[model samples]
Target: MKSWRDSVRNVVPYTPGEQPKEDGVIKLNTNENPYPPSPKVLEAMKEITNLRKYPDPAVSDLTEALSSYYRIDSSEVFVGVGSDDVLAIAFLTFFNSDVPVFFPDITYSFYDVWADLFQIPFERKPLNEKFEICAQDYYGENGGVIFPNPNAPTGALLELETVRDILDHNREVLVIVDEAYIDFGGESALSLIHDYDNLLVVQTYSKSRSLAGLRIGYAMGNRELIKAMSDVKYSFNSYTMNEPSIVMGTAAIKDEEYFQDTRNKIIKTREWFQEELRELGFSFADSKANFVFAAHESIPARELFEAAKKEKIYVRYFDKPRINNYLRISIGTDEEMQALVRFFKSMMNK
Candidate 1:
């Protein structure tokens, strides 16, 4: 019998959170915004009557808007289906070297899956005891460095100065910043792009903009790096970010007022939620993202996850040993957080 492709053999792909197709589950497992996208997004999609015509292969309008938003040249921007698509393109672009790609041991787990799928070599680096990125650890080896700011699952942020130090010290390596959740509250490495040509910042409209379903993400860097990623996309699927998504994406990015208000609301709710969790004997990482990483000293995370499921609430937990005891709970609205807290109070670490 013919087997599946070599890459497909016994491969455990990344498991996205349980998005129940059923009618009633409060899903907070994914770090999605609680708000719907701006009405402009709806208006834009409604205006698009032509489904037969192919989307602009270049995604020039969205790119230009994003470039103008970031004050970077349009040539330095490349839009993709999601940051995952662009990150995958990056794996193809800069990870062709024999050396292992390096990233924090506990970052977006999909980074490892992306490497496995692409058959790229990779090495994991432990984060500092404070759960912060240490630039020195990334130096002297590897083909590239990639990690989220206000890193995933943990949500611990690294300062802008530390970022500059890392890029300044590691001149040879391609430094990729996966800023999928950056809009929550963190310094963007995009600001450092003019100084370091190797820095590539990948971001999504999925988080702060409330457009995860739209599947639009873009990368910012110098023109040459953007060109390399673009080449990878063209070789695979030229018209990657389709018309509907591009339209929604443009509307999403352009709606700065909604973006700011929603992010601020999440931050406010997160602060109150953190205090409530702390009172319940839960330890959590200090976060600047839309989620908090936490576990109660008295409870096993797996138990809480299942219990929450039974209660029709969803939060994220990993089976990986170090993080198994912890849960990555997304910051929902004030009422949602209160409900989660109330449930936790009732459970009492059983």
Candidate 2:
């Protein structure tokens, strides 16, 4: 039993949200777009008849598409399998020092996994009682820094000026602002990439573009950081993206109007859903992401999660310290969310 796994790889891996298989299940546990991907994306995927060849190692089409969309240089863009893959590559390429990287203790659950898997030293800075990252806590000397823009699970967004403060303070190390949920309403720190060489903004097609199945993500930063990540990517796996994903992701980005419509619809649904939750006696942060971090006044989060599951409605509940009472409910379609609200009401009435 004392093999390679026992000595160096002994750690708890990140647990993703449940992906229920039963039909008609209101799947809202994961922060995936409830809408189908753009019609253009599907059409583009259908055109890829040549599946035998390897995808472009450079990922040229997708990279150029991202650069064009963001109005940044092609040299500043780096694409990968997903934001998770991009962030992992960044961890491997940049966070190589004795000093510990810093991130919010309650943000994306995967941050710690990447740091630990890469054997990089890191510290989890606690969010305040409101589950907000205190920008001052990230001021002092550290290794690299990374955090979700709207901050995950909690869905509380840190403002741009405050992000600038962290960037200003940590000039010596890389600062990554994971904007996975920014399209939900939060301001991106991407514009600051022009002023700061140390800033790298990682984004994904999963949330905003309704292309999670395509599994494409990219980063924008100074040419140096992009080059470094690109080098690591090529050495590790040149074909990080498949032909279908590359073409489909580009098509998804190209249909900007549809993208905005879906994003806005989700935002509107979230606003309506928040008010409904408040009326049902649940308290939550002012979420700017596609999900709500909520806890009922009297009901335990575990009980609520189980009740939702029994009703064929799956929502995320993190049974962790300090956040055990809260559930992270992803915004589903209007009908799906209404069903969830009705289920909650029935439980409360009982």
Top candidate by TM-score: 2
TM-score of each predicted structure versus truth: 0.96, 0.98
Off by over 4 Å in 1: 1-10
Tens digits of lDDT, candidate 1, 1-350? 56567435555699998888876677889999888888889988987777799999999889989999998899999898888888989888888888998898989999999888877889988887666777888876788889899799898888889888888877887999888878778989988998999999999988888889989888899999999888888999878777898777887788888888888999999888889989999997788999999988888999999999999999998998578889999988888888899999999842
- For all candidates, the clash counts are 0, 0
After superposition on all CA atoms, what RMSD does each candidate show versus the true structure? 1.7, 1.3
The number of residue pairs in model 1 that clash at the backbone is 0
Worst 10 residues of 2 by lDDT: 1-10
lDDT of the structure predicted as candidate 1:
0.87
Q: Candidate 2: how large is its RMSD?
A: 1.3
lDDT tens readout by residue for model 2, 31-142: 9999999899888978899989998899999899889988999999999998999999999999999999999999899999988888999999999998999998998779
